[model samples]
Target: MEAFERARLNAYFARLAAQFTTPERPAAFLITHLLPERPAFVRAVATQTDLRAVLPKPKSIHAAARREVERVTQCDPLSRDLFENDETALDYIEARAADTPLVLLDVGGYFAPVLDALCDRFSGRILGVVEDTENGHKRYADCDKLPCPVVSVARSPLKDPEDFLVGQSVVFSTEALMRGRGDIMHGRPALVIGFGKLGSSIARLLHAKGVQVTVHDIDPVRRTQALAQGFTVARDREAALTGAGLVLCATGAVSLRGDDFPHLRNGAYIATVTSSEDELDLGGLPDVYTRTPDGDHVTRYQTTGHYFYLLNGGNAVNFLHGASVGPFIYLVQAEILAGVRMLARGDLGSGMHDVGADDRAFIAATWLNYFNR
Candidate 1:
């Protein structure tokens, strides 16, 4: 009946003053927020105590999420500096532009300025070809069915790369967000599962840092890419789980509710950049720890459930919350281009990795210099 009443459902909030801060309160709110599209929990909480007055409108919740996303993008000190009017990001994209017969696929809340920035940066080198997919094209198409180049990758890739480039924004955003926060990501192994795009990016980053990375993906191309990137890719999920010091799932595929942790080693860290609504089978895993974003959803692991982890439990770390695709693109471009440049100069020796951290740091600092300029 009362909003704080729902908060009573959570043991973690036993000492709460108002009880609205409990996981139960937010969980109830999330349930009400979805499907029925109403804030039943908010209203209930409001009716019970002074908390009602503070309840944000349903539309405001969505607006808040958007605002949070935008604010994060603008203020990400590490990434913003790297991408603020980035020259290298532009240049790298331009080089790719010349390589016609490419496809660009954008998904999970991608925007046009990013696309336009890429296109404008590429300019003449950009073969008059770009394609958008999912929400990317629908949001950016013009009357002429063309994107503003600076604004959209508004169509699927045609047969020719010169005609369309399927942009991948989701993957870009995850990496960007993580880089912005900090280079180091720590979590339990079972908490991290699924070797999707986001998974591979994080793994590559860790691998570059000399951390052992174990990845599982059904796609052979993905496995090959991981292997090529100097990561240990696994065809069998069980095999991949071995020696997983830290794991994070980037897989988008949904599964039934419960725990599905592959036998985890002690103190292994795990996180997922996947959706949160669709539960993973986590019931059988070690009950040692559970964490979820904002604490609404949780994956048990670690010592204190109170420590609330961000990547597990149905919701994805990359798509649903946090990170910006624009910055991700900028960083990825910076890394790739630097690699290309080094190779062009005959500086890199045999079996050279894609882009080294020193180069990426230089790129970031270079962007920071420009940002200050």
Candidate 2:
């Protein structure tokens, strides 16, 4: 290993040990690296002590990973994106939104500019907007000022439904998977595995796109709800992988079994919207990996391999990229953006699926403008 790489690895493990000793295991984290190259062995190392290990060295992975991890763990960055070029960010966001009205499940605070712009341009035309938080009900109740309505189990839905639709209210969930982290919802072939708040929203959007959707969660009730929403429901994780162009693991569970992905066909993609990449053992797969802007360090186990392509190593797909527009703001952006997509596609009129490209671009642009402003 290079001198800097060795030093970085040492520092990373040391930090992990320190964190293990703390009363709280960081539920989520954003690791930034100053190293120029990604270490070949970018894998999750969780000891029996529960210390999560990551080499937040300088590289493409760390740079893009900052926003998602920081939001959930409440861990602040050592520095800020002081020199972030809005133009480039805008271009990137626009490009991603160009041809697709993606149903994004913004988890654990993964919202960025691209999402915001999509909403601003195509208000009321996006697909379903859903959010999951520790105190989803309370979060929605406390929302006095926001672009959308807050939806929560604790509150009465008889009130203005539109308020929550725009995220005037927010949902807070205290699930271990979230561990107080947040995420963003973008891209395509999105299949959020769990049918909790996050999974439902993703399913709703994808369904609108006329995309075949499937949802698998431990809860049979959620699976039933997904089925009602015109989504294919899989009772088993492995069953969910069948005919899925993309597999989005959002169960927030640790350690995904290899058998769950046995049928992952050639060119199939799997994005992780969870907490760690350690869940899936990609070494068993037969695909190559790729990296995203969010530092997910994706290893695509192509069909040539025995496994599947792992997006963000099954970590929070949002965290695999970059920047927090702040926690609540991030979720709000996600909700609105997805809502806008629904509106643009006329999905809401039928109370079903629809997503539009213009709306997608608008949300991305608006959020980008909001973040930099």
Candidate 3:
């Protein structure tokens, strides 16, 4: 990353860290993707309160991120701080900080296990949590009772624009991946398995490429919106899967199960847009088909006489290339910082909370002023 770009990131993050502060802040445990832009945010958090640890997502770790993380951690990074597995993170935090008061910053629901295990012993020690992704938001929401406040920017309007850009990147990366294999997306039939903000963007962007787009959303409201938007709604999912040359899982849930595999077209390509690895039953693929390594990011699965390709080892294809949103991601990152300040205050009750309107406006205005300049 350029020094100028790094300065820009720190500049924006500095504004948020300055805007939100509490007299007494809680010690923080952060879980985020190890991307180029991460170090700036990490430094921004340090300016406010105690930063106990940083746990990078396994799938999103890149060489640039490693260098940045090393410098950010002063080159003496903790072995427990750079975990790739969710369980390892849960175990470390649960063991080390079960008695220490903590505020958690989570992405992709890696902290969900901690929330589930929040019994009496862990309750007083955990001040609050800030969640970043839809998958993580859902995981926290599903918790029977949260002992502390959990704020999420997952569905906030501040995150909507970023999601659209992310949708574009998903297509951009996938097409780039496929182009490497001598495949063209134009005029090909594609099926998108979700109609949320991200999924809707994917559908529209796919249509823009002249690909016949079919959407399958379990939610009736989402399906209605997709149909009204002039995309084909898959009333017969099997038939849709059978005809689709490409299938993208956008739902954070298990979109493709064991039984759903037999319906796919031979030589079809599969990918996920969501951060959740559970979007597809990856283990179930090898159960029913012969799994073969196909290239850098491609995996071939032979189903009897027919076979299909999976991209990025069933993870988000956007991660194949670094999942950087350039400066647009700062809008949401700002909200996360604001969330950190909120958690430090310890005012809100236990449950999932949305980003405050003030935080949203500050970021939107910050983004507009900087970009428009």
The TM-score values for the models, in the order shown, are 0.36, 0.38, 0.91
Better of 2 and 3 by TM-score: 3
Better of 1 and 3 by lDDT: 3
lDDT (tens digit, per residue) of candidate 1 on 165-260: 111233334334444545344442332344443355466455444555666666787778767876666656555554554556555444323333
Candidate 2 is scored at a TM of: 0.38
Worst 10 residues of 2 by lDDT: 167-176
Indicate which candidate wins on lDDT: 3
Q: Which regions of candidate 2 deviate over 4 angstroms?
A: 1-191, 235-237, 277-298, 302-307, 320-327, 330-373
Q: TM-score of the candidate numbered 3?
A: 0.91
Best by TM-score: 3
Model 3 residue 272 CA deviation (Å) reads 0.4
lDDT of candidate 2 over 160-228, digit per residue (tens): 232233111111111111222233222324446666554566566555546567677777787778878
**C-alpha RMSD by candidate, in order:** 20.7, 21.0, 3.0
